[model samples]
Target: MIGYWIIFSATTGNEFSYLTKHFLFNFNNVEDIFYRNYGKRAFIMMKIYSFLLTLPLALLACIPVRAGVYEPDKLRVYLKMDKRVLYSDEDVVLQICIKNVSEKKNFFDVFDSIKNKPGEYTTFQPLVYDYSGREAEITVPYKLEKRDIKELIRDLERRMVELAPGEVFIHSINLKHIYKLDLNTRYRVKSLFYPTIGEDIVITSDNELSFKIIAEKRYNKPSEREAVQRNISPSEVILLTLRAEKDKNWDNYLKYIDVEKFINAYPEYTQKYLRANFEEKNQIEKDFIKYLTRDRDDYLLHYKIMEEEIENSKRIAYVNVIEDRYGSRWNYRYRCRYMLEQYKDMWLIVDEVATVMQGAKR
Candidate 1:
């Protein structure tokens, strides 16, 4: 029986090699007990017991090992855009930020300055997606002589910079010069970074940034006559808020908000809270715009008023807004309160409170 078990175990070397060594001492003790006390009658019973005990171990050994989802390296990279919406004539500024999250210092080769010439360091490759869903790689063109390349390599070899833990290195490049953009078309851009010229370590952006080119401004300053003629309601104010953020029109957005009433209603917000002193109305308006647009993009897919309550000159509305970002949809439900006031004989939006409901994401 022992010889039979040995032959069965030897057939599966790779799968049960480590486990066989672990169970060998115990199996030897069991075999000694069976041979000394029970003799031949218990030999067949011992063989059956050994087979049952090793069955689970054999099954476990056949299972494949899986790798972890997270990356082992401690370096983090991110890309940001200065503006989400741009004109065709304007240059798009793309910034790259790299940070070392590990405790140890890491060395990286970067193009800090133009010491010799071009082709000294690794260039960034940007992925561009057009409105027609066509994707293309846009590369920056560079020309370098043989001597320039040699000098650049020498410069890069000597210019290896050390990054301490939690330290960030930032670089900015103009994409408009590298790639030509079409007017009235939306483009999504993602920047890829390589830490070394040999393409050893690579990190991509956390999220892609998109920008739309417009032939003319969708939002403009309304004249005094137009402002007076427009009837401002709570629902209209909500619509204006969405349109203003979509157009990045801060000036037109401010017209719909009553700054004094908002400050008085939400007095907990101070200069430190806003990161800017709100001594002037313009500064307060800017701070308010920043608060409303925080962590949001300049595009809205859909919006609906979930519920509304109106009594006398006050109203409260629960609005649902959906935004599509990088092929993922995010739903934001806001509970907004509004107070109606007479301004130049027209009902204007005065005080307001906007709170995001819990579990607002789908």
Candidate 2:
């Protein structure tokens, strides 16, 4: 019997070696004369059997050149988490970004054959481990390995997505939905990306993100957001937010600005947050705010209100501010423009756009 892949190769019009095709042509003619001579038929049958035995091997010997991010040199998979510590009520989110690093652009990406988005559909097959060295459970619809490799390869080749050099495709994975994460435990997530779906070609990113889930934080007091919300100008709101950031007053700092809207300013965050569930939305906010509150030397050093614009019958305002920022390694001066909106008596910063200035100091 012909092997399934041999049939697939023929049906798909995969070119065989010239010698193999020539022999196959002759073998087809030989099969018609089986009744004429038993001796000739037996010899032809032996040759046919040998050809069948070696066909698969021949196919393997000249495997097609795999496209996409198959090797470390071609692409990079980065796994990252905004928050390393989370409350039990929050979702554990992991961001997977695949970047094309090769000089040549790829027309077909690994994600094409995947049913939904890779991380969203659990096709990433992410491995999660608790602090105790026990792996978390992940139940999914189907395993790729059980399916026909030829089918996977064929589907992958058919899907065309142009990924240029330095371009990235990002996906989100919520471990909270995939794994049974328990409270008060630490876990590490390592992700696998398939540029070509196979055991040998999986790209295992060296990056691993670990986070701890503790009991819900209920003791934290609600900020006196009312204090900063009333009768404030756009420039004042910017100053207040900067002061709160410098003082490490996260609760009050986030109150001066629309946290969700500000985080959504980033394209990546906007894409994920727009489709997120209630729990995931809250987790995203927490991760973003918590990240901003973390200790860093790059806090706003100085800012000057360069210009201000108020419109929409004074309900909307914009402020152009020059800022100085420095970390242990580097320093930069930026010109930032902020957008603020007035709701009732409260003026809240909703958006900000910034550009770097090449200079010695502000």
Candidate 3:
């Protein structure tokens, strides 16, 4: 019986002292201040007997107790991230959820470290923030036991401290731990039990907060070498006409074709137009046969020859070409950038602009 009381007190942190005395102790031995008197005896003979006679009745205290069964408090600690995903330099929000299983209110302070003594419970606070700046600390209101209400408060301060400006940041949260309600009998009897626990729940987040650089333009090369080192391929430039012909997009076709290159290359047609406009003699008839039958292969070679002749006159050439001969008008201009590469070996030209000029005089 003494062992049973000892275990009960230990389990409840010695709070069962009243229950032990009133229910488990001998009623006759109790001296209520007003009722201090000799206990009633079954008989005069038994009364004279030693204390050992009542000792047997103490055995009744060992009746296995079944009163409030010791069930673990259903404690669930979890971390919840806000629905909005924050970008780099943006604020992050973390929510803390605490549940109490007891049928009373509980007060607890959630902190990163443990308190040294009984009075340090109220000294801890969590930091929080919004995207603009430092927000506020999250506080758990009076948590009612038995009935659990979910309280969502942002822990912005903790998140900001973990991530620095422009750091390779990944936002992940840990629940850390949980502390529950433990009754402090030294305080008010009405407040016999309060939330007394340690960190048990670790809250973590899978998605990280990141930011996108709004002003930066993403291209293949860096900014400094943009002008002198610009790469121009016939394939890239010729796409203007090919795409226009394929999708029949006249706007792009007109916008992209190289008019100057066409007139310079097709001298027979250019001379005929010049003669009609300036009353000079025309040379179109003399070159008519070659112009009509010239395929991409012949025309490209002639163009290469003309470019070389011009470079020869200038005394310098950036590129050289043996010939500019190509297959056909369509295939010749199809992404002519590649053709320019073959021609760039011996010819000097700006880019692979379109060879055919739309609406040009014959």
Leading candidate by TM-score: 2
TM-score of every model versus the real structure: 0.34, 0.36, 0.20
Report every candidate's CA lDDT.
0.60, 0.70, 0.32
Per-residue lDDT of 331 in model 1:
53
Predict model 1's lDDT versus the native: 0.60
- Pairs in steric clash, model 2: none
Ranking by lDDT: 2, 1, 3
Encode model 3's per-residue lDDT on 254-335: one tens digit a residue: 4543333333455546655554532232344334323533342333322232222223344223322222334444323211
TM-score of 2: 0.36
**Between prediction 2 and prediction 3, which has the larger lDDT?**
2
lDDT of 1 by residue, 1-362 (tens): 44435533654575355434534656646455445544686667767877887788899999975432222266677788878887655677888777778777765666544544443235455667886788744443442222433334454433455677778887777776567677777888887766664545677777788888777555667668867845555566667865876677877767766665555566665444456544665667667667765655423545555544455544433333333332135555445556545555334456666665533345
lDDT of 2: 0.70
Sorting all predicted structures by TM-score, with the top scorer first, yields 2, 1, 3
